[model samples]
Target: MMNNKISVREVLVEDAKALLQIIPIIDKETEFTLRGEGEFRLSLHEEESFIRNILAEPRSVMFVASCNDNIVGSLGFRGNNLTRYKHTGEFGMGILKQYWGQGIGTMLIEHLLSWSEAHDIRKINLKVVETNIRAIKLYERFGFEIEGVQKNEVKIADQYYNLLSMGKFI
Candidate 1:
């Protein structure tokens, strides 16, 4: 019952509106999490600039998942800047709240994996909040391992949280 009708494609500058819908989803989801406390608020202008930066970089790529003409998720990978780590790329992803748990995140990660291989990105890494078990498990299923914990890393709402760094080799 899987449908390829849900399309994943490179994100374009014109997709601002479609992608904007997911920002609130991210905000609300992370609001209760350690990163969303009173600090690190997401801004439309910042996100817009981020999209442009990723698109402008030569060794970076961004992708969006769309269904029935609406974007439901987005992901990206940026090549490591240091020459010694050039084969490695950092990655991240987010899905609209309504579309989560329906395999959108899974498919998005899978698609990114293939894209990484094609672009010679040999490794991918990201950091997740230690309390987010679901996301940690999802990354585990994709062959990512817990690299380490960043102690007292993020201060959210008057509390501190650890960031569990995770990574995978393509």
Candidate 2:
């Protein structure tokens, strides 16, 4: 078990470098994410710009989890500014392999929920690979319902996998 307390906070421009390092590591550790190993190639300047943009958008937010001052997880929500879609947003998250089962995911979700409620977000959505049962269960536990499935949404190693679209209304 991890003895260090994990802290989750909004991403800062200064985190760009650390994010560049950790994101690809997480990608390499899990097939559940869309990007494969060594596929995350955001340059430091691009990452900093992205962070600035996210911060400037009132309906969008990104959070990072740190333990012992090291970033180990990240979560982000992106919402549309259009009137028709302003109340809903989609979120994505990732955690380092060593930090799995350490409640970091739970903290991130809780923070997102609180932030969504305060920001007038009515619904939250996420997509997960169908075979990722652990993630599916976690979403379900948080009251997200599987709204639909996309067949063969992802191809890996010459095999196809389905994707589950899940949502929760705040």
Candidate 3:
């Protein structure tokens, strides 16, 4: 989806280097994810290896949103490897806090859902901090429903928070 000069597309292996550089920054700048600042510590080689694995997976995808060639956001899905769970997938996404509320989140989810449907994935699952009301609302807008809550699943700083388990079936 394109609006206000933001572009989204599948990430390529060559993007691993740039992605590795920016991922930690994004993690550090966002409080809505499982990882806190500087928690996503990975060597360049490790990140490259990880990206290669994601690229090699037949039922997984990583999409990035960019503005002027700088990566601003990412959304991804990983399908289950087990034969019995092959029809299911899990997703994760994050946008640079500075770029929030520009409709980028909606575009990412839309892209993933369309890709999931085309890939024949029947179910998609995700988890969000219960306090992340904006993300919860966005997911709900796209048909995701809360299935359960893991009480006190995340502890940030001096406080604990619940994690909302959400899913959507195509």
TM-score ranking, high to low = 2, 3, 1
Arrange candidates by lDDT, highest first: which order? 2, 3, 1
123 in model 3: Cα distance from truth in Å? 0.5
TM-score for candidate 1: 0.83
Any residue pairs clashing in model 1, and if so which?
none
Which structure among the candidates has the greatest lDDT? Answer: 2
lDDT of each: 0.78, 0.94, 0.87
Model 1 poorest ten-residue lDDT run = 31-40
Candidate 3 per-residue lDDT, tens place, 94-155, comes to 88888898888988988998998898899999999998999999999999999999999999
Q: Write the per-residue lDDT of candidate 2 for residues 49-141, one digit (tens) a residue.
A: 999999999999999999988999999999989999999999999999999988889899999999999999999999999999988988898
User: What residue runs in model 1 are displaced by over 4 Å at the alpha carbon?
Assistant: 1-5, 32-49
- What TM-score does each of the candidates earn? 0.83, 0.98, 0.93
Better candidate number, 1 or 2, judged by TM-score:
2
Q: Assess candidate 1 and give its lDDT.
A: 0.78
Off by over 4 Å in 2: none
